[model samples]
Target: MRAEVGIKDAKVMGIGPAGEHMVHAAMLCNDYNHSASHSGGAIFGSKKLKAIVVHGTKRPPLHDKAALIEAGLRWRKTLQQYSVSDRYGVGHARHLEALPNNNMQSSLIADHNRGFDHNRVTQRPCFQCARLCPWDVEIGEGEFKGKIGHFNAGAEWLDTFWNLGVKGNATLYLAERINDLGIECGHFAFGAGVLFEAYEKGLVKAEDCDGLRLEWGNVEAIDKLLEMTARREGKWGNLIADGPLEVAEAIGGDAVKWVVHTKRGVPAMHDWRPHFSNMLREIVASGGMKPQGGGAANPPPDLKYREKWGPLDRDDPKGWPQSNVIAEQYRQFVGLMGGCWFAQMHLKPDGLNSVVDSFNATTGWNFTLDEAMLAGHRSAILQSVFATQRGWIADHDWQQVGQRFIDPVPDGKFKGFTIAKWLPEMVREYYQLSGRHEKTGRPFMNTLVQLGLEEFKEWAQLD
Candidate 1:
């Protein structure tokens, strides 16, 4: 498609065999390694559409080109000053003892530095990104020797590393191989971890896995399983393709205990147990287990949330209301502007004022911070309504809460803390603050009317 469309002029987005087979964990990938990973790609594949290509001759007309350029430079400068760079790629998380190990059983890995070396890794930033976040790594020795692969720093790299490294003890080469195959790494890891747990309990036998040993860190078996899943070749592969939750249900018995996911799929790499705001965001987000915009990580320093909530404690339930309010606005702003999350991280110190200025400068709209925040709220409400229309109402949102996220961290900095006890209250606070039904998670009639979405009220049953 690129060849026919001319490489410079064309941009293409498509899914792989996993999507073609309607695998639940499938994702869409474009030219610059950007992926709509959270958006299920199987929906497109189910329509029999292979790919979409765009060749645009015209650029969008900016309200003030000089102002936009100046704003971009300022934003870039702020990001460069504040951005966190990882030296050892994903392995840096291990050094901080922050990497999720053994399917989130713990956060620390004692010997995570075994295979990763600074010399073997090179930083690779995305297009137009000020933060040099991603890495191209080479494995000097191991089963995956001589193989070079690309991985994003922090969560993206950590997910693959923890899933394969901490859980299976697999080499970094295997993780890179999976990335190349276009499989969703987090989902794959969750599925693999479930199978490993079942194997340990004798629930999954050798014949069930097509004569392959179902053991942690069995690199060759994992590779074969990934292939089987993509091709839908065997019983195990076919089952895993459906996703970890479905696979657990099919296996029955105690296997469900090993599965960790919400309604949509596996949670993103971050563990919510040690962070109350993160836990609330995970539970109340429109898409199941999808990362919501505002949380403890991107708190507006200028905001009085600190004065109101006192201190930020991982277990404190007091922070949820303020956190939810900020997150909703922040996420909305990022989505509307087509800006990355890291940009939000840097501009957060100035609160929404910086974001408002950028938006106004780009479009020549004189928007106050409150108006800009309402735009985000409007978008969030629409998304919630859409999810409700699809039968994923508030009642159904908490399906995986007890099974996956409620458990206390057995060890680490957050030992003995459980988000389960406080989840209901936090969720209620979120719904109330967002002007949605606390129990149903549906947008209130007033909320729709306020957002000028009065026409959608009846369709959403809010009328």
Candidate 2:
């Protein structure tokens, strides 16, 4: 891609065989390792679009370059206080706590830890960013002899194949293959496992799976399933290609019980059973799969202007609804800044005050922290309103928190803790905080008016 662009500096963002075949959960990759995800690859392939190469040679106009740099430094300084940033070059921890193992069925990190412990990893920071988290790995031998990438991050690992019961360096092969094929890793991770469980319970047959015995940590069988899904080859491949929830529905009965998801979108990758606020965020907004922010001492949105109000106790389900409302506000606000929200999330200065300062400096505009938050709030409401139009306005529709997600953790630190009991009240409080009717999940007209979205009144109004 680099050589074909001639003298122009081209950044190629394209799909692979998965997107070309229009696999249901296909994702796009930018410049090789940088993931440009959100299940958009199939959309690109459907339109016969392959890759988007951006060749630019213009400098962005900045209102106050000096101030922007200063603000960035301040944000970085705060980010430096975070211990994880110090391990930037060390790559993702082989085993991080609370990563949700075996499709959220257990919390134990799989015992299959092998491969890549000896592979050298180096910091491959994105352009102009603090808290460098991206790592580059080049395989020297084995099945992944020529692979070049790292398997150490949430989106890369969790959303890819980590949560599906893989906990070893064998994750490298799955990571490389998923990107190579361009299918959604989460889709394969969740769908493959549930189907395996289905086979175990006799829900799926050997004939359906190309005669391969489905078993846990069967990398070869999993790999074949991935290939089949990407190519939509054979009956089982086409069946599971729609992802876990759809596959469960297709298989019917006990199959759906094993699938973990919210709104049929799986998760941003986290076991949210113990974290009610995180789950609430997804109920209101589509992929509120990210965990909460800041210390309990600071609370979220700790900008000088807002007061602390949230699920102060991480384990307790109380106050999560309120936290999610604010979380949605902050999350949507981050989205407005364009991708890279992951970088800005922890630096909220409390959040937004300094970042808003930097944004204003770059655009030469007068934007405030409140305005930034308001914009974020507006984005969440827009998604909520759109969801309502699609008959997703009901609390149950949003609360599709599958049995696997709400079911008690069979083992781990959160043993016996389940969101099942608290979910109803938590969802009710979320409605109150978001200013929506309890029965129908529609946001009130006044709520729309508050967000300056009175135009969506009819749509938000439910019969």
Candidate 3:
């Protein structure tokens, strides 16, 4: 709400200072986007408006259908009135298609600056409490005029929505989160593990790490190491942001090939090399130098390659194809609601359709399930084109996460199994089906324009 309102002292959970600063008009978190620790919205503020907090007792209803049927609609409303953010509940997306940023979009210019703040807020919300509240709006006195910006912290590794249910171990945390059955963030652990090994090998001594020991299997030590790395605390810390690949080259170690990163030196997930197709894509899509083009986080329900082998069992084969269809549909569902993808997973197709019905009842959009999928696919394709311009390819071996399955499972229930060998053919088939280039690994230009991304033709100079 503060973001939409430009309230300097007002803080919304899960936002960075960069987001807080770029506000003209903001939306407060409604029942759908508000969480126990966070709120999403557009904000506005005035010259003298230090803060504006609209508190309420609305809680999300419980997910138990039997309980809902027993409690009745009237009872659910009453329960919601007193709901706190901590309670477990699922809320559907409410399409607020009338808002700015294509119903809901962040300032691209601000996002880059807000990277640190995003990380900070994710790691610890306390950072916001300290500095988020106080800001000087340069707008002269007016009802809704001010240059607003908040003191947002950086991104936290655990701030990702999917990490909510996983165990937290610093050394293995990256691996767990990246390989989350419900989510996928591409391969990041290969580099993290390598860094840990480097530390153990005395490559990064105590002095390089600012007195912190980078021992293997020590969560505390790894956590401290990450903080230092994120903060750039010591000499090595300052250079650490260069990422594992660069670090390996600079330090003169045999770690570059194993560093497995996309363009920006961010390491590929643990399974980079073994999945050569993915690695190839990672290398190509990442500007052939940087390594950030790989997909960010994907929801658990979005895991498409469940058959390749992992700890989780497939819920139903019907869902395999249905799941993709649903996933595509859900994206459109979020666009209508003006919600983030991280928050959209809680609303499956059926649940989302219910919200659309509510919206039509209130505002009369008459949004249909088919319409939702079209919107999502259109938007997603645009994003895919952007990835292609940045160098996505079908043959990149380092980009995919399935490469990790080549090695036998070390200690899990699926131990000693190597699915890596089977991943390429499967992923390649997926690529072919998805309409990627056969040799260059880029998406077909027609696909880009088809997805409402005509701008890419001009951007990439493609005819």
Candidate 4:
């Protein structure tokens, strides 16, 4: 296909056999290792669509080509100057002490530093990425010795390292192999952890996994499971491909306690116990379990809230209203513009005027900050409505607090902090600020009307 279509002209979005077989954890892989890893791939496979190939020669109509080029150059300069390490930091779970280990069984790893040596690793950025956030680790010893593998050493890296490294007790090579598998890391971790737990509890046996010992960090077994999941080969693979929530229900007997996920797939790798807002954002937003937006601490100097609310507190419910507003705006802006979040976060202190300017220059939409925000908010509402139509009720929108979060942080700066206590307050504040019903998480009639989404009011059944 690449030869016939020409690689430069053809843009392909494809799925593996797991997606072809409608695995719930199936993901769409595109060029540059970019994936839509939110269960949409299964739908495409179910429709018997192999791949979506785009070959376009015509340039998109730009309102002002010169202005757009100037904006691009400005934005690129901002990104190039930004220090990714200083902003988000590096190291695979080394900095975070409360990194969830062994499926949230413990928060601490005795020697997480030993999991992956920084000396043997090199920075590998994504396509045209200035940050170079991902890591390419060279394994010096073990089964995958001398193999170079890509690792996302950001917020998402902790889950992969924690699950395969600390919990599975696997080597860095195993983590690299998992990354190569192209499965959602969170789902893979949860599935592997649950199966291991089930085996430990005598709920499942070696025979169940085709005589593969379901032991922690068993490379052969984990590797086999990954293959089986992608190929949808056996009963175990079939069950696991369905994701942790379904697997738990299938296994029954106290398995639910081990699984961590919301109604939609596994949430991102962050343990939200320390930050109450993380939980609130995930629950209220319609994008499934992904983090909604950037953090509130160190507000961009130009953020209007700096003048009104002063310094923000992540844990304080009073500050969450403005925080949620800022988060929603940023989330919406990124979604609409298809820009990188890291760039937005790093450049935020300059405010979102740049985003608005770039967007206006490209699309010829004379939008002010408020208008741009409304556009973003409208997108969120549309997504929320789509989710609602797909049977995502209001009650199920919030994070399902499990035993992992229920168990207080044993030791940390925020020791004994419980997400359950502050969740409701934060959620309420988020709804009030975002103009959604506090209980239902639906866009209010007034909100719809205000956002120029009055046409969708009836379909959304807004009151």
Per-model TM-score versus the true fold: 0.89, 0.88, 0.48, 0.86
Local distance difference test, each candidate: 0.65, 0.65, 0.34, 0.63
Weakest ten-residue segment in model 3 by summed lDDT:
96-105
* Steric clashes per prediction: 2, 2, 70, 0
Per residue, candidate 1 scores C-alpha lDDT tens digits across 137-158 of 6765655566776656444545
Each model's Cα RMSD: 3.1, 3.4, 15.2, 3.5
- Error at 59, model 4, angstroms: 3.9
Candidate 3, residue 9: lDDT:
52
Cα deviation at 31, candidate 2, in Å, is 1.2
Among these predictions, the greatest TM-score belongs to 1
Ranked by TM-score from best down, the candidates are 1, 2, 4, 3
lDDT by residue for model 2 (1-463), tens: 6677674568888888778888777778876267755558888889999888887789878889999888777666555322333322212223223456666667654443445554556666667666565666665456666567653345445434556555454566677777778876656777776777787789888776677777766777777877888888877688666767887887788878888766777655555555555555544444432222212323455463465553367667766666566656666666677635655654355345667777877888887777876787777667766666777745763467578877876776668877677757777777766767765767788788888998888866554
In candidate 3, which residue ranges exceed 4 Å CA deviation? 1-9, 12-192, 202-208, 217-224, 251-254, 257-329, 332-336, 340-349, 358-363, 397-406, 438-463
| Cα lDDT, model 3, residue 443 | 51
Count of clashes in candidate 2: 2
Candidate 4: which pairs clash?
Answer: none
* Candidate whose lDDT is highest: 1
Error of 1 at 272 (Å): 3.0
lDDT of 4 by residue, 38-85 (tens): 547678788998788888779788999898777666666555333333
